[model samples]
Target: MTLLAGGTDLMVDLNFGRKRPERVVAIDRVPELSHLEGNGHVRMGAGVTYTRMLAEDVGSAALREAARTVGSPQIRNAGTLGGNIATSSPAGDTLPVLAALDAVVVLRSKQGERRVPFAQFMTGPKKNVRRADELVVGAEWDDAGPAQTFMKVGTRNAMVIAIAGLALVVDRPRRRVGVGLGSCGPTILRAPQAEAFAAAIFEAHGWDRHLTPSDAELKEFGRLVATAARPIDDVRGTAAYRRHVLAVMGERALARVWSIT
Candidate 1:
């Protein structure tokens, strides 16, 4: 039983930790866990590189867009979505996208396999997981929704830690707003209040399907999103700034979803 992904978080921890495990194994080379298969319901290999994700014709707006934002081409070439989930960093590029897409994680062990929703798999920052013996063979998602958009605020445009990042998936019939906050709390946050807030706004305005927000509605929505954040001021930015950025980004996400549709 060992942790295997891109080895990013594990390698880092092992270097810093005094107690090193005596036994170790790497399954990154497992061919079965490295291919993207299944179309009706998407199944992503645990070792599927971000480079593969970006290059694939697999047209998931959420995954496609996220693949582009992941690290440098080199990092993307090395990092895996399974690694992102395994790391459980709130700032993980793929996480907000997965959470918004309402994706599922597949965990496997010698015993068998179990699937957990993305949100449930992510209990807290740098956490949420499977047993020591379990391997994250892949992830699965269903496309019963609208196109999506991903947003994040880092010091620079790319290759930066997200102060706050959000993903919005709008399937008019199942209209939903999924928000993920990084570096704001121990775990990525889901803004239930903000979701309802946006839903009300959408409901009141009628299902235009092309939902547009007035400045008032935008501000109100932002405030609700702001409340969902549990940001702390650090070297990167301030809590107030995180709240404000998340709000602005969220509005942009909303606009993008509409435009895409």
Candidate 2:
């Protein structure tokens, strides 16, 4: 049996005869999966559509920006965040944002509830650890703040698969930084070395101060981010090109988040 929410990815599979599930359960209208709430932290239901995310400012700035680039208006209206999580596509626009935020996936089963870190949720391309009996109800994360952004390089300006995407977040309170990479790996990847390098700079410069990293530092950070990618040569782009795109996007995303000229 298969579950259906937005039907954006699943419908494509069905239409193309890629997936012929013996049973398909529609859960788009389940009230429990449509809530969006936030205080110091945010909890967005799996059924929350990209359109809703953009209108309501559901997650972070990066998330809102990613939502804005998802697809056509109609696709945004139907494509749900939970559906994106369920599909676990490497190129899913919001995946990198979620990774940068360190969001927690909330899965519910008849037995009880389970929460999994976003890092551990996706095991491979289009695969996750969700059990057959589990339903991905929502995702939750602490507010990162305004110093964050998401950017992607695609074939065209709109409605195109990303060649590479990057999400960068700076947590002032924690004096830490995060970089999430997409469309350059089998699964969304966090750039640990790049994050550590940025955090070190933030520590030295003072988190509250506006400090511009040297060109060499910025370039090295980009290189570290590029090194984390596990890409393959595909129709969208080549592995080398993806790495280059990731490096550029990573550097620009960090610079943008820092408000650097």
Candidate 3:
């Protein structure tokens, strides 16, 4: 049996004969999965659509930007965040943002409900730890402040698949920086070295003040982020090109988050 929400991803699989499930459950109307709530830690229901994500205050700038870039307007209207998480695609625009924000995946089953950190949620491309009996209820994350942005490079300007994507978040209150890479790995990956380096710079310069790193520092941070990717040569692009895109995007995203010119 398969669970269906907006059917944005599942429909394509079905249309292409990639998925032939004996049973399909439609959960779009489930009240528990349609609500978006909380403040300190924003919780968005699985059934929440990308259109809603853009219109509502989800407490993550990166998430909003990611949502804005998903497919076309029609796709955004029908595509759900839970669907994106369930698909577990490395290029799912919101995945990198979720990773950067350290979001929690909320799941429910007959046994009970459990929350899994985003880092441990996805095992690989289109694979996750979700059990057959469980349903993805939503995702939750702390408010990382306004200093965040999402960037991606695609073959075209709009409605295109990302060759490489990056989401950068600056948690001023925690004095932490997070960088998440997408489409450049088997799964959404965080750049630990780049994060630590940026955090240290933030600490030294004072989080309360607007600070810009030197050109060398930014380049090094980008290099560290590119090093974290494990991309493979595919129809969309070459592994080398993906790494280069990541490096460039990582730098630009960080600069945008810091409001650097």
Best by TM-score: 3
**lDDT for every model?**
0.75, 0.90, 0.90
Q: Across residues 1-261, which tens digit of lDDT does each residue of candidate 2 receive?
A: 899998999999999999999999999999888998887799999999999988645758889999999989989999999999999999999999889999999999999999999999999989999998999999999987778888999999999888899999898876778888999889999999999999898888888888777888889889999999999999999999999988988788777777531
Assess every candidate by TM-score: 0.88, 0.96, 0.97
State how far residue 171 of model 3 sits from its true place (Å).
0.6
Answer with 1 or 2, whichever has the higher lDDT: 2
Query: What lDDT does model 1 reach?
Result: 0.75
lDDT of 3 by residue, 94-195 (tens): 999999999999999999999999999999999999999999999999988889999989998789889999999998977788888899888999999999
Local accuracy of candidate 1 as per-residue lDDT tens digits, 1-261: 456567766777789994387776876788898878655567888898888887645436777777787778878877887888777888887887777667899999889999999888877767786777778887887763545767778889888888878777664556665665566767777788877877776677664455556777767767777788888888888998998888888777766665445
User: Which 10-residue window of candidate 1 scores lowest in summed lDDT?
Assistant: 171-180
C-alpha root-mean-square deviation, each candidate: 2.4, 1.6, 1.4
* Model 3 residue 176 CA deviation in Å: 1.1
Cα deviation of 236, candidate 2, in Å: 0.8
Tell me the TM-score of model 1: 0.88
Clashing pairs in 2: none
RMSD in angstroms, candidate 2? 1.6
